[model samples]
Target: MKIYKKGSLYLTEGGEMRDDLINIYKDAPAIFETIREEIGKVVVGQKAVVEQILVGILAGGHILLESNPGLGKTLLVKTIASTTGLHFSRIQCTPDLMPADITGTTLIEEVEGSKHFRFEEGPIFANIVLADEINRASPRTQSAMLEAMQEKQVTVGKNTYRLEEPFFVLATQNPIEMEGTFPLPEAQLDRFLLKVFIDYPSPEEEYQIMERYTGHAEPKVERVITRRELLSLQQLVRDVPISDDLKRAAIKAVVSSRSWEGVEYGASPRASIGLILASKARALLSGRDYVDRADLEVMARPIFRHRIILTFDSERRGVTTDQVISEIMKAI
Candidate 1:
């Protein structure tokens, strides 16, 4: 349990420092499985989607979940909060939602017969925040999240408050409903580490969902990890290494997207950094201490899909961002 001490030296079999590495490589997956098992008990299936969310968490990054209604975008994030033993808060985004609604606003209060202004913290203070139907909110309201996500702090009336450690924003959006839904600005989209696309469940999975739901005794999930342990895992993931060749390849892949025929805009340099971080998290989830080439390739899609924009001509031809990313993957 103390394997994560700051500077303690640990040696295995040959008295090498590999024990620390071995601990992460051997233990991370079991820890991951512990949470996945809990999630599987209630959530029918979306194994890949679940894994990508876990990758985002381990990478200490925010996630944007997009899918049509009833695909369980809400349920997935709520489950993550319950299983991780983290405090959860939700914001129902609307055109009427103001910056003060998400962040704290100063209010006058009377204490000890004296009137003074105090800052009232908002829902963004929790460890896990679900911004449901975020695109439905006006762009001005959406812009309020900019500072909170990037700085991990909310500023109001010249005062700033730091968010809790391990804080994560899991925002949801309905891809098909564009009426009155504001497309997230590029800068806002870039702030998210990965955009996870959810698809409808498989037939077999749908049957299980039906059976599990119609029962009198519904499913319950136990907390699989504590806040402290989750923080440690995030640190452990960052400690994983990558080779120069893989680094170059990742950059090359991102750079190639810039001039690709169908793309109006390509992923920025942030995509390269996100690609590396996410791949390392993937490797750690597989109980590996070093990221492999396969890890880089597997993470490319989720990290780049939202970052690139398809041209109007490409849209007219039915070209999609995912297809463009697929081509880049093959060439690199």
Candidate 2:
């Protein structure tokens, strides 16, 4: 249950949390509420999805968003980037996209009659990169993003370039569009901390969406938090305490997935790690000083859904990954 990062967390001589750290934890809800209020300016609903995205941000993890087309997935990511004041970039993935197109390429340049190679950074260099319709990209192009997403760095040649801090890849994919699309490899999918499913909005929410977009003046959202503040929040999220019992619960859910009847392949150790981290972030978002069972219950599906593979019988019976995860949690 012990977690360590490069920077130290503040604690007193008795090993209790410092007053300043406690203050930050107490203020977390208000700060996140302001962020949601800004995002609500444009997005009409999907509060749960928004919270999960915030969890990914606070956990310093990448996210994969899946939904049918025209569900505002791209708009949501854009709004989050805008609200957080993070440098944003978008890559419209397509079959023709090359590996160099994503990770950048070395280009020859001449200066003062001397020619040399210079690395040109790609769209992946931003703080928050939106890989729109990621499944549409060629496998080669998708693979190019693995290093940047996992290692937070890119290698063009013998030299490697470090991406800016707080880097995240918020990728989107259409669930129904299978034609002419390359499915992401298991390795690539494993890299995503959470796979969020965006459902259709309610009629009331849709009506409000129409009202907002049909108007002559579009709704405007202002940045609520800066990069430095967000970085600090990320650090604080890691320091949020989780009891051994809850940590064991998170691990048990992951382990149960391996022997779960419907699951063919279980989640990796990364899932256990991601589940714990996501729960800590969720607790902080709820303005709690410690992780709760509710946090683990709520985050289980997103953490394990993409990591496990369903059995043929389960697929034929129309059982989904979420259902399997739910059973695992209940058993644990």
Candidate 1 lDDT tens digits, 228-291: 7788778767667788999999999999999998898999999999999999899888877678
- Clash count for candidate 1 is 0
- After TM-score superposition, what is the CA distance of residue 75 in candidate 1 from its true location, in Å? 0.6
Best candidate according to lDDT? 2
Question: What are the per-residue Cα lDDT tens digits for candidate 2 across 1-332?
Answer: 12223246646322545445555555668889999999999999999999999999999999999999899999999999999999999999999998888888889999999999988888998999999999999988898999999899999889999999999999999989699999998899999999999999999999999999999999989998889778868878777788899888888888888888878899999999999899989988887877889999999989999999998999999998988888889988
> Once superposed on the true structure, which residue ranges of model 1 sit more than 4 Å away at CA?
1-26
Model 2: worst 10 consecutive residues (lDDT sum): 1-10
Residue pairs in collision within model 1: none
* Candidate 1 residue-wise lDDT at 318: 92
